[model samples]
Target chain A: MANLPIKTVGVIGTGVIGASWTALFLAKGLQVIVADPAPGAQDKLRSYLEKEWPMMSKVGLGPGASLGNYKFVADINDHLGQVDLVQENGPERLEFKRGLFANLDAKTRDHVILASSSSGLPSSEFVTDCKKNPARVLIGHPFNPPHLVPLVEVVPHPGTGSEYVTAAMEFYRKLGKDPVLVKQEVPGFIANRLQAAVCSEAYSLISRGIISAQDLDKTMTSGVGLRWAFTGPIMTNVLGGGGNFRHMVEHLGPASKVWTEDMRKHEFDASNPQSLNELSNGVEEWVSNIDLESLEKKRDNSMLGLIQEKSKDAA
Target chain B: MANLPIKTVGVIGTGVIGASWTALFLAKGLQVIVADPAPGAQDKLRSYLEKEWPMMSKVGLGPGASLGNYKFVADINDHLGQVDLVQENGPERLEFKRGLFANLDAKTRDHVILASSSSGLPSSEFVTDCKKNPARVLIGHPFNPPHLVPLVEVVPHPGTGSEYVTAAMEFYRKLGKDPVLVKQEVPGFIANRLQAAVCSEAYSLISRGIISAQDLDKTMTSGVGLRWAFTGPIMTNVLGGGGNFRHMVEHLGPASKVWTEDMRKHEFDASNPQSLNELSNGVEEWVSNIDLESLEKKRDNSMLGLIQEKSKDAA
Candidate 1:
């Protein structure tokens, strides 16, 4: 498939991630067609759009963007040949994904790239049954609340054509998203794996009583998080090296080894009642009383301001 | 120390960290006495003060705060019996710190607490030689650019008094800083260790050519970084749990384990030419062309804005 400029996007699921994708696509002035079988899915999607439109406007919508330029269908077949690309946010079960992709493959055009927002499962695990055109299928997983967050991890399977990967990446970039091509299809990809590494240690620390959840959160929100907001660990490491990342490795590598070696692994079984209660109680000590909706609004507003600030010099 | 309100702060060694502390001290309306023997150190400190004053002003200076309230001395003896507390940012050499702290301990009043801005070395490593009032000495290590970043890891040695730790925490909190009392004196402390955990995996991925430094950075700066800027991984994990952290751990814990098991460890030896070249080239590809000064300004400005936003509802 050629690297076609995506003008219309079909959203295969209209839950949180799907609704977010809809908002972003609409903000970017792309025609969006959405389909979901759940009752009131369309109403929920419309409500989400209305609530998020003001924030989207402040974040700066693309030229000619309009909330009215969208279509929602109860049948997946309605999206056939209607969208240039399709974002599948269906249930994460492999069997469900396979069935959906098979039907989508038969229905959509051969060139219409089919991307799944599977966070952990690689596209190959689900796209195996897309006999008609597996080359156009891949994972274009966005971080949660995709409309606001810019990262889209585009992981293509071995059978996926290079052109399709490029097309999906270019499409996300056109929507003012930061699209990273996952060179290898590891489970959870890069972000979640990295998050797991840090979080495992965080869990161990909390469980061992070395620190409180509030302090751990403060350590990041006030300390390294500021740096990570703009520069990743690698770039920060480079600067830590005086612009030579190797120097940092030489000096800090042993220290890193020591920490990583001392790092603890935490495994909490869902079926274990004791472990669940302990973890739940600990979280309550820190954030149980927080008004989550208000906090989310604050977070979203702050994120919007920061995003606008970063995009100031963009061409 | 009875959590004595710190009024005058003596800053030893005026490098970037010391200068930043000086700026923050002045901004907080504390009388600052700085001592550094290096030639042109005073000029650099003055320049840093002048350069940072506007930003600090924007960040909000306390009543009676002024650059004029600061005094510079070439001799450490000048700070004797002069300031209520001391923040040492001396060279990261054990012998130098030992000798300097011994003199500082003997010269300053026993009631005054001494806090070192050492990034990795614990207070026990150097305070052993302080003959007088070593119990008042501890590490109050700040993140880079101490004035801008709010986190200060207050680590105390075994011999240090609990009251001194409490005093130090109270002092930093009074300055509008986030003081996390590190119960253990481990190398690199919590934030850096957590950072090392993530960076270790990042390095292995880059070294193995699974991903480029740029995409790896985008994965954080665009995805997890946003969450981290407001909520640390622990709180984020708790939120991920549907307000029941245990639930998240139960459901996502297995997934985290899978990722952690797949994680790789990296140790880069500076003497290894291949390691140095590989790491350096990877970072250069991402950040080589960017103007460092302007980039730093952008980062600092964004940080200032975010800090202000976060502080809006503070009691």
Candidate 2:
């Protein structure tokens, strides 16, 4: 079967991620059908879209793109017949997702791609309950503020058709997103796990009193972060070693190994009160003087400028 | 003794790092005396300073700052008496560093701070041979393109004076550099270790064919890296969980642990021809159609713009 063209996208659960996804799809000239059970989801989503549309326009908007092209419904089933694709952003509970997928599978067209925005859960876990054609089910997780951040992790279940995966990747690419394929199901997918590795080590260092949270953030914002904003770790290694990653490894391997061996491993047990207190106390102390909203605004503006600068002279 | 102000900076070994340091110091209105033994080193250093001066001026130049304020010499001993601080960027070998530190110890003023630009070698390893006040010697490692990148890792040997460490930190701060004080003498320091952790995971994913190098780069440049450029992993976690880092850990800890345990460790051995070939081929293939030079230019320009934007509302 040919891949379905995604001109109208169904967004289930109009929360932050879903709303942002809706805004992005709209900016790409796609009509978005938003479904959420919350009492004021329509108002919330409308305000969000209005707030983000200017920024999206500055970034770029497809021909005839406008917020008026979207529709809001309290029921997902009502919009299933209208959208060519469904983006599920329901609660992360497996049971809830499983039940939702089954209902979505029953109502949506057989060829419509049903993509869950779950961060870590594999689609295979939920699709097993679906009685209808389950080959169209997969995970298309986006980073936060999906309209701005360009990553969309396209993860496919083992039972998912290869063509659907390709189609999903193409769809996201058409929306100006970089979609990375998750060949195998891994917990937290790729980005989250990588983030965890760094986070765990950071927690350990802070707990041990080696550095303050402000300094740690400064360490990144001024150093590794600069390198990462343009390239990945592997390419940075290649550049570090003068176009040879192996050379870098050979020269700096022992030091890196020692550090890795000493890296802290934090077990995230919810029952542990100390861990939570420690992290919270640290963060509050670090942000004592700075207002979070302004800091975040500064960050967003900088990201916007960076994206604009990098896209210039694009081939 | 009070910390001596740094009006003159001596740059040893006028290579890329040294030349960059010279450009930065000169832009900050510090008279820099660059010393290198290599033939035509003066001409090369002069050319580099000339090319970077315009960009440096755009960023900001202190009063009386000019490229002509810098001088070049073929002997380190000649500039020791003239500079208040010496930034060594010699070859990264313990034997050579030991020799250089000893010479610098004997030639420099008793109050002068002798700092190394070594990326991995801790100052303690080489400063042991500095008979005259080894406490004054430490590591002042800068990220690449010292004139542009803001991070400078200031690492102190245990025997180094507490005052010297504080002075070094303040000095770098005055020059508009984010100097992170490495609490302990850890190899690879904080930034590089974090980078290594991420690199190891990325290499593992690529080797397993989960994602291509190009897509991996995109994943970072578009996702995690965007957050990181503004904040560290720890702060990001705190924000991720709505001002609670611990909440994030409790929810995502198990998945993160699984990924960390499964992370790959690549040992860089020059004798291992296979590792070199594999990585080189991978990078070349990812960069096949794209020109590396243009890519790098785009990165640098984006970085400059990001820096400009971030510094606007600086408190």
Candidate 3:
């Protein structure tokens, strides 16, 4: 086992999420050794890292951090010797992930902790059967780009030790991220389920002649949405009925019933596609740039400004 | 049914919400007459309007439009003479509301649409039996201070006529406010139910040793919250896990089990008045001088800056 301090973290893929993760680690002064078989992956990640690192540093995160420490390789096994942690951003294919874990088990000595960036597939399915040290295998799901969005769901299988989970949490925290531990493996985790529930209602409203998508968006952005940025849904309800969610439950229950009668299912009708297209175009115009760098920079700058301005007064 | 281009709105109470509604109406350049029994409410509202009016002008929303048309009153009936719409903001007591609706119905002969700002109870229970013109009574719920945040939930009871609902909707729309027809009444309407669901989960996390409340707040603010301000919850999910929400759904469906299992029936346990005192004190310090005037002024400056920035982009 290698005993050098973990200044460098290795990455397995160089797609949007992988590169984003690289930028985050590199920005925090961690040397990132990224290995991706895809052609020109290193060049693409380098460019993304250069732009996003500066923006992230502008917001008061971990000081003395940037993309200067990032080094990329075309071979996977070459990274196993050096990394303190290995965050795999491989294709979401079960067989492919299984193969990677199998190879990693043979190549790496018993030092590096292997974390897969999978949102859906439980860590057990991907790593348990292959690796000799499957206990180190865990899921580290980031929200889009790792640099800007700070929520990372650290999920582990039953055999996974608590020590590894603790270490993983600390690692993410050091990077100035909000790492939420998933007690058990489940689909979508915490944020996604809540999002789906909201999306389901939003889509149903449009399908049931309740309101247009733009109006639905406006209803959120202008009304409940602003307060929600400061407080979670439950806290809003607490203040909503004057510090009594029970009162809200007692009152709004009828309206929910009125809606359940017409709850739209999963089938996407013809109108939905057209509406989605219209919405997509509108979103593109608003967001403008589709690249990872621009999106990350925009999120970082705006987020910092908002936090400085509003966070001071929020409960 | 005296109808001569119903141009003005009468506000019943001049509390925070009532004042905000007046600000919104006046900002839209419509005539507004405000009445409240509370001492100094008239002066406070005027100060609020004066500060907010210029901001509205700075945002290119118009100047004289919001300022010249406001009238304050000590008696409710005085404002009812020329107003075409009435926004009720009485105390949260059902009896008090029933009594007020009775008076409002008898006081004016104008085809004025009456709407309540109740967070929970539908106008149906409050006005189903009391009004001579029962069709005029509906619910118009706004997030606090309607001037800045602009979505209004326009909910009409079964007894309420479509003409009143349509007219009320058009009125809000004409004010450049987003009005959503709830289609049917639900407890907490559309916004607070969603809020409750999120809060329940968040509170559970805090109570359960899974994470600290402050950390959760930071997580939301840093991770999900920033994206929410620009992209919103649904769009964030669409961008979060690869492409549209399908992949996220597939992965998250299982992960949701942990949340629901942990979410539990969380009662807002304010038993520890210590925490409450501390949090309140913190918010107070941050907002020691944040009266309606200051809030309006801040909103105006931001909106003005936002408009100018956007206009520059357009140019």
Which candidate number would show the highest DockQ if scored against the true structure? 1
Over A42-68, each residue of candidate 1 has an lDDT whose tens digit, in order, gives 899999999999988987799879999
DockQ of each model against the real complex? Answer: 0.64, 0.60, 0.22
Query: Candidate 1 regions off by >4 Å?
Result: A264-279, B265-276, B313-315
Give the C-alpha lDDT of model 3.
0.64
TM-score of chain A of 2: 0.94
Candidate 3 shows a clash count of 18
Q: Which structure among the candidates has the greatest lDDT?
A: 1
True contacts kept of each: 0.75, 0.72, 0.28
Sort the candidates on lDDT, descending order: 1, 2, 3
DockQ metric, candidate 1? 0.64
Tens digit per residue, CA lDDT, model 3, B1-315: 433456778889977788877877776677888788888877887887776666566544644464768778778776566777888887877888888887888776637788898877788788744646878889998875566555688988877888888888887767666688887775566665555445544544444444444454545555555456555654565556544454554455444544333333332233445533443343334334435344444543553343244234325
Tens digit per residue, CA lDDT, model 2, A59-175: 689987987999997776776877799999988899999999999999988888999999978999999888888999999999986887778999998899998899999999888
Ranking by TM-score: 1, 2, 3
* Model 2 C-alpha lDDT per residue in residues B1-315, reported as the tens digit of each score: 428678999989888899989988989999988888898898898888888788898768998898899888766676688889999999999999999999999998888998999998999899878888999898998998687788999999889898899999999989888899887787677787778777767766665566777777777888898778887787676666766555677777666666666563332333456654665567678755665666665666667777767767575
Instruction: Report the poorest 10 consecutive residues by lDDT, candidate 1 chain B.
Output: B264-273
lDDT of each: 0.83, 0.80, 0.64
What TM-score would chain B of candidate 3 score versus the native chain B? 0.79
